[model samples]
Target: TGDLLPPLVHLGAAAPSGLVRIPNSNPGTPETLLATSFNMHQVTRHKLTLAGASFRVATTPLLTCDDVDFHPTDILVDADGSLLVLDTGGWYKLCCPTSHLWKPDILGGIYRISRKGAPLIEDPRGQELAWRHVPVEELLRRLADPRPAVRHRAADQLVSQSQRTEEWLDDNFATRPPAVRLQLVWILTRVGSDNAVTCLRSLLEDDEPEIVTAALKGLSLLRDRGCLEAARKLLQHPDGAVRRNAAELCGRTADRSAIPDLLAALTRTSDRWEQHALTYALIEIADVSALKQNLTHQSASVRASVAWALQSVAPDQLQAETVLPWLTSETPLLQQTAQLLTAQRQDWETPLADWLQRQLAGGGSVSSSLLAVVQHFGQSEHVQRVVLAAAASDTLAASARAALIRGLGKSGRHPIPQDLTDTVVSLLETSHPELLQALLDWLRASERSAAFNRRIWPKLLAIAQDDHYSATIRLQALALGGEERPVLPKPLFEFVLEHLDAEQSVPEQLAAVAALREGTVSPLQRR
Candidate 1:
């Protein structure tokens, strides 16, 4: 057993467990010794240690326990002098007790440690073969190697010599096993040559679903128009995954011609996830005629998809006859979709405002959906009604009120109505931080208007000087006050200077500086 208390060992102690000597063929080179240190959690090599440990030939470990818990059990020196280390992945204690115990078939691994830059003495497993000079046949054979590292190395070598490798794969693709064929398709994509598209297309007709899917993925990477056509045919493939993959490939290629195929898939597919994929693909292609045709489809999902997709399409082309019907659709998704589309058009502003006013006057429960229309299209007259409703409605959500406040700020460039100004000033006493912040933002945006500055500035100055409010609200109030030129009393100026020298946070100090700069003296004069 290796030493257990490695934490107390002197720094750089080998704590060597499985030590093996590598025979040197050339006497001129120093003798090489390989050992695993359980304490250091790595396999290291050294030159012949006679008294103390031999001077380190290399400081970096030959192999590190980066992934697995490598409690190396034993080390073997092959007849050819290559090193093999047996790692007993001590992961049982690391897993939950209720989980399945470690299976040796999956957990056991053998790591090969071979010296590079020099040939191994009489190696038989082709260990000494240079990757660049390796025959295409030899590299292809290595694709089926039991170890992933070997397979990856073989693939990398094949990719480097891609022209020759592509020719070889095209010549013998049918004779290879399905497993090997899959690997070939993967490597061809990495080769990224004109030949890859041709090869990937042939595999699209393979009997296996996995092979077809792999081919589709490979073709998507090429982004050729021919690949887009191939993917279009797979939209109706029997396998759902194949269809989904095809839809995604069409989206990535962005071929507008695929819109009809995507819409056809959207009609027949009941799967929610598949429908989402097709919808996203349609959105990316954005063919206005194709999307408009799907608006009246019986599936609420399809109608909703059309609604979402239309947001990106130019608004000028959307006729009222095509868009207005979806606004009254029973489905919430369609209703929201219609609202967003309606909000983007300036011509629809009057009609949308009229609808909002009717809903409010009828004492209807103003849905956030309805409020959104007002927020986007409302002007001065509309803002007066919404502000009054918001101030009067106790059942209104804070978020809805905040949205309305923001909408009022954006309503018009002219002076705000006195009633709306009074309503906003009254909200400063509100306890809800979100509502208060929204009110402050609105006040700041409207501060340039003389009427707004005269009405709101005094209320802001009082809130900033009040110590009972939290520092965050006070800072917001101070910032809002700085947006206008309100005459401050001497005590207010002295009050701002006091905070600059006190044990205040940086934000509070910044707010104090802004207040002095606007209310008392100019910042340029102070500098």
Candidate 2:
């Protein structure tokens, strides 16, 4: 519940999942210039990104830059849990100082930050070990050293002897703890050799989901067909993450072999996003045979997933027989899934048109899924009547009305029908930002539509000039009005001119510049 502090200057590489030493470089005395704030003091508190999470460290400076000449360049964590900071910034010149005071001194110092009573480190660098001629086994043991510097250096040495490393891993990988094994897994995957793949395959059933998922991720890189059995078994894993990683691996491998477990998992899995991952695996396999055959499977969930898969990856091959059951099924989720499929294929026009008519006649409510698909059906007399009626309804929800407007614009089916012109232009009368944005987006796409006639210009100009609205709304209005670079009448010219001085947002200024790019003033006004 405190103010968000600005970032520390010149932060170093991320540490191994804890607070590590780092520097605040170019500590030019506190000042602001050109909107850049240089507020480095001999003081600080900050958050750092470590392993994809932000951690706020002690809200006070651990060690202040007591001397202006001391700017730390790097920080290292010793095995004893002390931080060794390298202050090499003393020798370099940091320009752009607002104070006009600068110092250039060739002086540097190494400073250590440590707890008052922490134990002393033993073999911090394994100095007593045989580094000049260390054995591979010794290096492997050091991979789990309490010090990151020690572990990484040992890993580098071990990996250099690839032949012996792989042989040792084959016999001894399981003896290590999860943390050490995780490191080994990443190193093995990076090598990705024949023996490495063979070793990784055995860990598919590791007690740790992380270990199994990491193994699958590594195996997936090679699209190794040998792991299909492992992948198939893991598809039914209880952990959603493991299941997802396994599903991705299965998809990448694409074995012609059937994965009935994949369909079974789809029936049982409750997470919608995870179901999508499983369904994606089916799509990648694109087993035209399995997808079509499974449409008759007794499990409603499997049938829904199968029908959706065929429609997604093999739409033309998706027979009406395959999708019809779910489209007309009493199960609401299944029917909605099928209805969504209609938005994808032009051949499914009848279902879409009939649904639009129902939305108009059945009252104004639209299901979230159904609303997403309706805009794709806006063309021809069958669509225009219902879509226009929805757009013209002041009582209909704003989101539904906005969607209908989007549909009409996408029809790209030209020549605004004279009868529907009023309803189409009527879209501009609403002040709701979503509806206005949808209309402008349509206008941007259909620049030559007769709907953008003399009547549309004034409303477009007013929306662009209004400051009471948000920047996004104003930006869209400017986009439609600016698209043609029209020689605007004087009042219309002033309308677009007012936006030129929008100092804060670069986008608003750019919009104004784009509107004025090539056009010139008319002679009638020039006189």
Best by lDDT: 1
* Clashes within 3 Å, all models in order: 0, 0
Report the C-alpha lDDT of model 1 over 374-464, residue by residue, as the tens digit.
5544454554555656644665666767766666666544445565666666777776767776676666555345566667777777776
Per-residue lDDT of candidate 2, residues 190-308 (tens digit): 77788888888888867776778778888988788899987888877776777877888888888657358788787776566567777778888889988888878888778778877
Each candidate: RMSD? 17.6, 12.2
TM-score of each: 0.47, 0.51
- Ten-residue region with minimum lDDT total, candidate 1: 1-10
Which segments of candidate 2 are over 4 A away from where they belong?
Answer: 1-132, 296-301, 319-340, 354-382, 386-416, 419-527
Give, for candidate 2, the lowest lDDT window spanning 10 residues.
28-37
